[model samples]
Target: MSDEVIPETTGLRYFDEWLIKKFLFSHIEKRIAEQSIKKYGASPIYLSERSQSISSLSEICKRRGILTGLGDLDFLQNCSLTQQHGARSGFVVLGQTFDKNLGEALQHHAQLIESGSIQFGSPDTEQQIAKFVEGIISPFKDESSRLKVCEDQALDFLSTAWDLCRSLIRQAPGYEPKN
Candidate 1:
């Protein structure tokens, strides 16, 4: 999405830089680090989109000795899952998006996770994230669930974003229930 502020919201609907840094940064980075350490090894493995934003944070992480220091995408080529070094990058940044776009982003990201294409060296990483996505998108299929999971996670959302996210979820891959 453009950097333009959303018309109705007087700000970008998903644009909450403060919250992103204060909450999402530590929350998700820790998750990635924890999974890499617990499941694989106590090695640094940062991951994100191919952009300056991630690269900048990654550099910070590396300088602080938080990770092995991979702000570039070259790490994906190395067959060193056994040897921890640089970070892996994905096309999407799930936790940083706006509430309106999150459901759809989660849906797309979930496919990558489930298909085993987005391996982060953690066996259950994909499953763990997929379950989280399922909860956020379930309201699209069953409105009764509402925003319980989001609220539980201390995520602030917009009412309009909820509807938009639900609609996006409906259009995401595997939106159809098998049952």
Candidate 2:
């Protein structure tokens, strides 16, 4: 698919710095440390200590006005997420944009869920998916069911993207993309 055809919302700009950070913390950093140790016989302790020292220095530079910490943090965090997604630097830009779009989409979906238009779960299900969706869209109305539609749509989009990536990787050799 052409780059433009991949909805800007589906790429990576939809994610914010904080969400990217959470993604990295949840998925990437530890894997990178593990890989480094396995490939180079590097000591995790030394690697972690150096990483911490570099991070501290970066913070100091940021505080001293030598660098914009926000940009650095965003770059580092996004880099990690992109790496985890097996996306290249160009794709990282796309992924960051997609992440931003995803955040906006989620916010919009949440609004719908809170409105009560999207109910799917029930007290018996114990899943609370319906209730969670309702809570997200509730601000629009004290009682509504329209939000469920939007939530389902968002979930579908995420599912499709996951499937597409899996298919693409399976079709290509040496498919891993570097950050």
The best candidate by TM-score is: 2
- lDDT by residue for model 2 (1-179), tens: 12223223334564554443343332234445668789987735333432332232223243554532345444444444433333322232222333443333222222111123333464445446656565665543432243465567779999999999989987898777668
Per-residue accuracy of model 1 over 55-86 as CA lDDT, tens digit each: 23333353554542331222221222211211
Question: Could you say which candidate leads in lDDT?
Answer: 2
Off by over 4 Å in 2: 1-139, 142-144, 175-179
* TM-scores, one per candidate: 0.18, 0.21
Model 2 alpha-carbon miss at residue 114, Å:
13
lDDT of each: 0.40, 0.43
After superposing all C-alphas onto the true structure, candidate 1 shows an RMSD in angstroms of 20.8
At residue 39, candidate 2 shows an lDDT of 93
Q: Which ranges of candidate 1 are over 4 A from the true structure?
A: 1-16, 45-179
Clash totals for all models, in order?
1, 38
